[model samples]
Target chain A: MRNSKMASHLSHFTHKTSFFTSNPRRPSPPCMSVVLSTAPTQSYWASIDAQIDAYLNKSIPIRSPESVFEPMHHLTFAAPRTTAASLCVAACEPAIHLMHAAAYTHEHLPLTDRPRPRPGIQHKYNPNIELLTGDGIIPFGLELLARSLDPARSNPDKILRVIVEITRATGSQGMVDGQYQELGLDQLGSEYDVIEYVCKKKEGELHACGAACGAILGGGAEEEIESLRRFGLYAGMVQGIQGKNKAGFMEEKIEKFKELALKELESLQGKKTELISSLVEPSLAAVQIS
Target chain B: MRNSKMASHLSHFTHKTSFFTSNPRRPSPPCMSVVLSTAPTQSYWASIDAQIDAYLNKSIPIRSPESVFEPMHHLTFAAPRTTAASLCVAACEPAIHLMHAAAYTHEHLPLTDRPRPRPGIQHKYNPNIELLTGDGIIPFGLELLARSLDPARSNPDKILRVIVEITRATGSQGMVDGQYQELGLDQLGSEYDVIEYVCKKKEGELHACGAACGAILGGGAEEEIESLRRFGLYAGMVQGIQGKNKAGFMEEKIEKFKELALKELESLQGKKTELISSLVEPSLAAVQIS
Candidate 1:
């Protein structure tokens, strides 16, 4: 099934849903006749339904506001309660250190900066320079979030820091702490995927445990919902920024900004007046001429 | 990578690692040279240390409770009022339905009658069975958790009825929502694996929203955890009963049950020597054995 999929994708474009010529003499696959004649629409629809079904059924509560992260909440609490107490007296810090390192280096990994590994990480997106701090002094991005959320702190400056931290974690330069994600996914896949998928779980956790923790973490469900949209936007933006597809990139954020602008304009009487002015001005000019 | 892997698995153990090996005359994969030239144990340790160093210095948290989701809690409650009550009337039922479907289906996916698709859902574990309800009234296996928690009436018979429902979710004639599992490292070759990577997301209306919803459906965090574990275990057991590896079947749920059981055991111990043999035994066994 896997082997045939790639060829089928190509053939689908050429044959308009038929993979092989219907002629008996054609050098097609043994079962190609059956597949071409009967399977195209069914398989196509099946695949679409599979993905949709996965989304509708299997994906976890990513954007939900209330009780969204409850499953993850159990997992997070499962985080060795002794983690805080055992921090100093442990050589197991190597594993913990590895987790932190991976968290800082990889994307969607869970690690804090209090246990910084070394001084710096990598260079990417010359657009901004972000480095890794081995220890978690920044501690679970607390320091970073603080830098951003604090009124006294500078937005662009702190965002710049977050930018660097984020880049480090996302790109190859960062380490990914997947064990936690494994805990979240019930240890479903490769350690690598654990952290990658942790993105989904972390999103769940924040929504589950709200308190000063929630206040600090912002596990509010609506915000999580926004995050769902935000992630799609962020990924698109990152891809575009990577110069993967300039058109896709430009339209992505631009369209989002345009939407916000339009919404704002609709809400404001002044903006409405300005828009109507342009439309009504020609009539006014004609009336003056008359 | 995938080709080599699938070939190796489908073939035999003798050809396993060498599946990726190059012809002696052809350029050998880097791994082959290491296979022949064993490194000094000290240097192996050194290299591991270096890798650890490199890995640690680069880690960051992106998706843990500490990273993505929890930080947004403060912002959720600012606009506490739902302005349009009429909107609630029109939207609430569907929203609840979506939640119920998502939560119930997600919960149901782990039942014995696993593939609860109806209206295109396996719905209940049995082949051709359709998924139609929200309250988890389906399957005898999952009904155990439901009836265990249903506040309307918690009679033993009701609980037993619920268990009976849950049993319907499991077994050969039930849901069989499909599955996913990772092989252990020693037992692994090349990349890690999904011993049987069933896609639950493609199964039914159960998204992760159900994982957390299990807590509510089961009536609390503690019970919800049990509900999830019981469901995962029962589904896995069904898969095994269907003739997959018995050990593999228990693998996913063992840790899950252990974790929950241990926590329960801990709380059960409380501050006293109240080692209520029934509750304390599990915890004591876990403490001693684990």
Candidate 2:
């Protein structure tokens, strides 16, 4: 469905009603589609949710030690999948990194006082993807995954690639850096040019990283990876400004980033480009300035 | 130098006399050897310090808006080199990941209240190793490094490998996870087996990652990489227990790890093995009961 149409439907909810409901009272059926509207984009979201659930079920088994796995299960299965993860899956990247993305995001949250208990049993199977949400139990969750990764079965090269892209995306260079810059801008106040630069790093960088990670994992060539990265960066730029509701040449800047994203997508080959374009439509559709 | 000899020198110092002096008051010469004792191991440390300083000077330039680079500059230059970085360097790994190690370590500190100002000018030569020290100036540093990496000049595959290893080392599976487990052990009160497991992760994982990264970078075979990683792991376990001054079974555990490390070293070919052994000696030497 068109962004405006979705927005209109969404606007009807009270301020307290989140865009995605977390209410336990709402009965959850076997399929999430029942809760979602018939709109194509909404269906896509449901499918992505299912995909995430399927991946988690297959990959992360319920382990012993309620302290570690419980919090992780809550974070991974219980919580809604991020748009970044959805976009990554939509682009056909391995969903494992999405787990990393979730953990990284959780790490930044202000919550502390995590569950504490020494680990029980030597977990034999270690997964390549480790979850380290520092609040407490989440940290041990990393250990379980590390143990789960069977080196003989896993591809070192692929694991390394995912690690590289995700770290670069989340670490000082990407999301966290952008956050730092945004905070800086808020405090000292800044000119338009400086604001734009900081916003790109603060916001645009993670989106770029996510898109680029998908392309990389999907085994896209250098040009394709670069193209997707640019697309995400530009898309993020437009989204950041729009979300902040900045005035003065905001429209012009958004248009510029939109065009940039379009240009990058046009440079790619085959169904992948089309798939990415469709995935990004909601973000682009957000530009109507209603 | 023998660990006992080194310990004797350290014992001579008053609490006011810091082991690794950060003070500028002491007389300085061109070489760091001036600050260190005449012992052979001390020279190795001096060399590592010089290497760190050199790498920082080459990678992190004196930029304008002194906010970001200054903090980063301080962190990189002032502190002694971590065995992880030194191991990575020894294994012929690219120095860029070292920049990341520094940033990640800095982020966890309690300091906050960073400078507020949008980034100035498109940093002409953005480095590939971006600096994201988010408390204030560090995040911008990630951007600078990201920009600095000229895509045409760098190898994407190698970069990705380094990223993966480093992130894993620091994240939930490696150091952070270990840290979380350590906290849990402290709270819950723990057993020797549990303590050993936790310490392996807490201390050993990052060291293992460092050694493995070096091996990978040095183009060691898969078996070789695994061996070095195992060596680092066992070695770190020994160091972790020793540092905590745990008695009884501690000596046995240290011997086991030391033996494991020695076995791995013996399995490797020629000078590379020698270099790694030399790099690890001081760490192992710290095991001396004196």
DockQ for the candidates, in order = 0.01, 0.06
lDDT score of residue B115 within candidate 2:
18
Note the Cα lDDT for every prediction shown.
Answer: 0.24, 0.46
Show where candidate 2 strays beyond 4 Å: A1-39, A56-69, A76-108, A111-168, A185-199, A212-228, A245-290, B1-42, B62-66, B76-80, B90-108, B111-169, B185-195, B216-227, B245-256, B263-290
lDDT of 1 by residue, B125-169 (tens): 211011111111111112112212212222332222222222222
Evaluated against the true structure, the overall lDDT of model 2 is 0.46
For candidate 1 chain A, the 10 contiguous residues with the lowest summed lDDT are A125-134
lDDT digits (tens) for residues B1-290 of candidate 2: 12242222222221221112345465221111121233355455456556545545655565643444555455554333456555554212223244334434433332112112223322211111122342222222222222222222333344334444554565444554455465452344556765786777666876787677656644456886798789888777776777674646578877777778878888765422433454435554332211
lDDT of 1 by residue, A191-229 (tens): 434433443223212211111121112122344324322
Best by TM-score: 2
